[model samples]
Structure formats: structure tokens, C-alpha cells
Target: MLLDAKFTIGQRFKHIRIEKGVSQAQLVDGICSIAVVSQIECDRKYPSAELWGKLADKLGVPLRELIGMQEKQMEVSFQIDMVRVYIDKADHTHALELIDELEQRADLLEHQRIELLICRAECYRTARVFEKVVELLVPFLQNQQIRQNVEDVVLCDTYNKLGNAHYWLNDFEKAYFVFNSLDPDDVHFKISNCRCWNTLGNRG
Candidate 1:
């Protein structure tokens, strides 16, 4: 998840940089010191509010778009192996109970709720209730706080799942729409893109 967040922020910064068509040094001029911009893009440090505002102004984006609030919500990083063990060995009832307990005590930071939502969506997906996944995820996509917190991969996965669910219901139009919402250049888009194309072919 940390990797996903890092990549998302990096991609956003790169997108803004390209949109502005300015060199790193040029972007730093009169905005932030050159070293600071370098550090921010490299994910070594977050930019200050003043620097964030300047970047947003230069890049023609909303100031909120440049802020990453998800980092604050990550209180503890659970071991992936432990999670896998629980998923693999525990019964559904027990798993649900554990998840419910975790959710209740999560106490997530500003944007951290998105992570929780994603986790919940996955759980719903595993239960083969795709409707529940959609129910949980669609709101997050539309929410400003959650949207800002989501990484590109998470966004891709959410859209892919939504498309998949619609496809299963033979709602081809909705599936196609969801798949088209993804940016082709994003790493997570490939599988959904293929599925969309395949569905189109079948329909034709």
C-alpha cells in the first residue's frame, strides 16, 4: 500500500510537471528552492502548504489535489503474511468477525478511510458479492477526501472490479463505460482493458 501511495503521488506530480511544460529548475524558480522540488518529486519529503499552493498554481490544479492526507492515517502496517494466514485458514464467520473488529477500531487518519474502504471492497469481492463491492467503492470514487487519498493502482483496481461486476450481470454498456474511465497508460489498466475489448468482441 505504501508503494501504491508513493507511485500515485509521483505520477500526479509528474502529470502536473508535464502539463506545465517547465523544467525542474524553472519550476522551482520563485516558487520553492530547487532542492525542495527535487525532494518532493523523489518522495523523500512532502511539500509544505506554501510550496504545495505554489505548485498547484503553476500546474493549474486545485491546491487540494497536491496534498496527500493518507499518510497521516497509517497508524500501523500489518504484516502481509499474517493477513494471508488469516484469509487462508480462518472460516468466513471468523474472518468477518475479525474484519468487523478491525474496522471498528481502525481510527484512520484524514484520508485513510479510503484504504479501509478498499480492504472492505476486497473482502466483499472475495465473498462473491460484487454488488457490495460496487456499493462500497462507488462512493469512495466520488468522494473528494477518499478520491484524493487513493493511489492510481487502487483507482484502477476499483474501476476494474466495477466493470467486472457489470460484465457478469451482462450489463455490457456499464462495463464498457467503467473500463473506458481508466487511463490506458496506468499499470493497472491492462487487465480491465483486455476484458473490455473481449466483451466488445463477444457483443459484436
Candidate 2:
């Protein structure tokens, strides 16, 4: 299934509003009707940038952070792409430096942990550090809290990363099992499944 690349402006507003425990009436502060605010939240209508600024001011999130969500997404994607490039170039040292920077962030939120782990795991995969990947990922997999709230794309990536670690270690049984657990429609699952079968067929 296709997913939105970033949160909608209204969605970012709604999440912060709920987190801050601010009511709709309180948020609008007589500037607009609660119905209008609700419509904005549902993405059925547009809220002017000025109005969004006011809402962001009340919600305690930076206006740029909310309105520029797509910008932030691009920034993050570029960072990850750089890491991947480093790995492909056999520059594990630089890739680890980048991963370490992410790990050092004191305010990393729950939603971001999985993505960071995925990046680090990719570096480890390139380094052929299979045991390190297993060490980092197994606990993430078993974390009830993370599993309960993980995005579908992240979940699929996690499965592929872990399965590949096992696959590279000659643990074909476990590797195929994890690959099979991924969502059938996910590209990660399909690619991993084909590799698993092809490898097994060659061995046979």
C-alpha cells in the first residue's frame, strides 16, 4: 500500500494539539469556529499559513517544523542516502560516524528510533558484521512498545534487515522464515523471498 511521505500540516497540528492537551476551542481562541478547526484537521479544507502559524504558536511546535515537514523529510532521506552511499563505497568509518551522530541525539523520539536502527543495521550489513545486526535488531523486534507503534514500512525494513543478517550467516531456515513474515505486498518481502529460494535452489 502507498503511504504519505510526510504528515499533512493539519495532521502535524493535531498531533501536537493532542500532546499538549489543548482543546479545539482553546486552540482557535475565538479566531475561528471549532468546526473550521476540525475541517482543517481532517484535511478537507485549507488553513492559511498565518492561521497555521497561530495554531503552531499555541501548540508549542516550531512553525517551520510543522509547515516544513516535507522539507525535514527530504533532509532525512538525503542523510540516509548518504549513509547508503558510504556503505557502498566501503567507507564504514564515515557511515558509523553518521549513525553515531543520530544515536547521540538526546531528544530522539520513539518514532525516530526505528529509522536510526535501520540505518545502523544497513551499515553493519555492508560491513558483514552479521552478529552486530542481530544484536541491535532482535531486541527492537521484541520490544512490545516499538512493535505496537511501528510504521508498516519500517516494520518491513526491519524484517528484511534481520533476515539478511541471518541469510549471510548461512542461517537459511531462519532467514526465509523472517522474510515470509513480512507483508506480502511489500517489495522488501518479495525481493528477499526470491533471493532465499534462489539461494536454496542453487545449494540443492
lDDT of 1 by residue, 95-137 (tens): 4444554556645454444555665666666667788877876
The Cα error of candidate 1 at residue 126, in Å, is 2.0
| Candidate 2 wrongly placed segments (more than 4 Å) | 1-85, 144-146, 185-189, 199-204
All candidates' lDDT scores? Answer: 0.61, 0.69
**Whole-structure CA lDDT of model 1:** 0.61
User: In lDDT terms, how accurate is model 2?
Assistant: 0.69
Clashing pairs in 2: none
lDDT of 2 by residue, 21-119 (tens): 999989888578899889978978666545655666677765544444342233444445545555655668866776676666676676665667777
Report how far residue 80 has shifted in candidate 1, in Å.
7.9
**Number of the predicted model whose lDDT against the real structure is largest:** 2
